[model samples]
Target: MPTPIPANARNPLRTFRFRIRMNTSAAGQYVAGVRTVSGLSVHVSPFEVWEGGNNLHRYAQPHKVNWEPIVMEQGLALDDTLERWALAVLEFARTGKAPGEAVKRDVFIDLWDGFAHPTEVPAPGPEARIRSFYVHNAWVSKYHALPKLDAMAGEVALLSLELTHEGWEPVPKPPASKPASPA
Candidate 1:
């Protein structure tokens, strides 16, 4: 069995916040019809997230992803990119940054093709419709620039994704990681 985290270990989730969003990609759909979900105003410790789940705080992991449904239609060709982009927007809303890594669709397919359908990460639920892999906001933002989220597609307009890491937690520094990065 894996060693358990000490009772006093600091929680990273408590120091950061989570933000998610939904969008469609029908030429002019990615920007339009998209909705933003703001996070609670307070930080949430991993203990609080796992709540009843055992060994929660002991494991430094991302909380369960509450994925949204795919809004595009069948053969929408845009569905795959749409969902992935929507998630990116939502992530930006929570982290103030978007995926900035310069990558090609081929690379993404290799990582998540088996998980979803066309390209997103594995959906957390059955009704979920995504196949593209999503990276941490910080990681993605460092290489990928978020597209304009409020506008419709057709035109390649870049939208500034709102980011907020509230309610998330960061393990408090114990004189070691002290002065921890503000989540």
Candidate 2:
């Protein structure tokens, strides 16, 4: 009998790190360790219909698609970049100022298949295979500042922002090239 390899054994792609880019205007604001991305998900509602009599087995029908909000966390910084970005949407919501064109921006979450590597401008390329997800028309819905501070050892202050987006789609990759025909 041959020895079977474990499912999670020696998988490089299993571990990944991600960074966020809030459109072109608010680019390069998110620092790697300062911010952590989470809660990028979608769910489909299951439709169930029950009538009188004839109960064999109940099957669920696929209903509307629901997209969950993307959550981001970061340590408090002096620049206050995230705080200002989130407040811009809040200001619009409160006074109906429309938030201008900058408010309606595309948010990109890029996943890199490895640990964090130091670079001036870290981007997805040959060295680190990256898969980016574009969240269309995103705006910060929730911005929670630092939680209750306590005199505890080794506690880091963190801020969180929840972004509500219309939809999320993966960045399209270029099609594979075809091999030349034999002469």
Candidate 3:
């Protein structure tokens, strides 16, 4: 018989308990206070192949792969990293000069185990991290600087950025270290 999973591991990781890290600079800073994240997905197109003798059946094979644009929304804050990045891309388009490394960045989304209270999600340490998605070669495609301003509304001001990325993959877990032998 197969071994059963432990009780503690049965629960799914909560979506709210996560962190977004953008490779904005060589220092590698984390984008703080992100309210929402979406569009972490990929689609593979399939091509149909039919053998000359086998008219009865057709085989479908994977072809081109496409990655969806990731959208992130956050309450407007003092930090201007998102704005600056978007402006850089705009400048590139205006001047016809390549933005080079300044516009493109790798984004990391880390999902943490939500064992704590909803109001008290702790910062994920290495062990607390359940999984991480690595978004490669992402550049800002759209920037919504301000939402529909309404003085009568009670909602917070939100700024959103959409990023087009080449692809994304799950970050691989590190190898386990071996215990030292008795001397």
Candidate 4:
């Protein structure tokens, strides 16, 4: 009989342990207080072709590819990065003039394996990053600055931004280094 895995064994990386960096500044700072992120997806339309001689079937091939708009939400806070980006997009739409390179940004999402580190290892940082996705040339397509307020309810005000991007791809893992020989 096969040995059963222990209940205390580490589980796969959790979705809650990810970080989103807007890449808007030189430091590529993480977007603060992000509560949820969604719409990381891609689709490829199929082109169907039928052969005159064969009544058997129609061949389908890959056609145009599309990336879904990524949506990010967070509780309203003092940090105005999201708001600023949304304003830039609005300005472009109103003026009919591109805001140079300000309208577009490359966003990076990093996922970490929270339970992968050993006790001796330092706290999770860049080394703990297991996967990363790069959303290229993204621009804010929609922004919701304020959530409906109710006097009777107590809840944090949330804001959301929807970003349309050219496409997204997984960041390639760096090549492993070879062990050095003893001098």
Model 1 alpha-carbon drift over 4 Å, by segment: 1-121, 126-155, 164-167, 170-183
lDDT of 4 by residue, 1-183 (tens): 999987555554566767788776787887777888899999999999989999789999999998999999887874677888898899899998876448999999887665643443323455567788999999999899998889899988989999999999999856656689899
- What value does the lDDT take at residue 96 in candidate 2? 86
Query: Which whole-number lDDT from 0 to 100 does residue 63 have in model 1?
Result: 50
Better of 2 and 3 by lDDT: 3
Model 2 residue runs over 4 Å out of place are 1-11, 14-16, 25-34, 49-53, 99-101, 115-127, 175-183
Candidate 3 per-residue C-alpha lDDT over 1-183 given as tens digits, one digit per residue, 9 for 90 to 100:
999976545244467878788876775777777889999988999999999999999999999998989998877884666777888888887897866538788988988777644666655456667788999999889999999999999998888999999999999756645789999
Predicted candidate 4, C-alpha RMSD: 4.0
Rank candidates, TM-score, best first: 3, 4, 2, 1
Model 4 segments beyond 4 Å from truth?
1-10, 98-101, 115-125, 175-183
Model 2 agreement with the true structure over 1-183: per-residue lDDT tens digits: 999976534333643366666664644344444456777899999998765585876778999889998888887864466777787888888898865435666877766654434333434453443577888998888889876688875777888888888999998644545689899
Candidate 3's displacement at residue 42, Å, is 0.8
TM-score of candidate 1 on Cα atoms, chains taken together: 0.17
lDDT (Cα atoms) of all candidates against the true structure:
0.31, 0.70, 0.81, 0.82
Model 1 per-residue lDDT at 87:
62
Error of 4 at 148 (Å): 1.8
What's the ranking of the predictions by lDDT, best on top?
A: 4, 3, 2, 1
Which residue pairs come into collision in candidate 4? Answer: none
Give TM per candidate: 0.17, 0.71, 0.81, 0.81
CA shift of 68, model 2, Å: 1.7
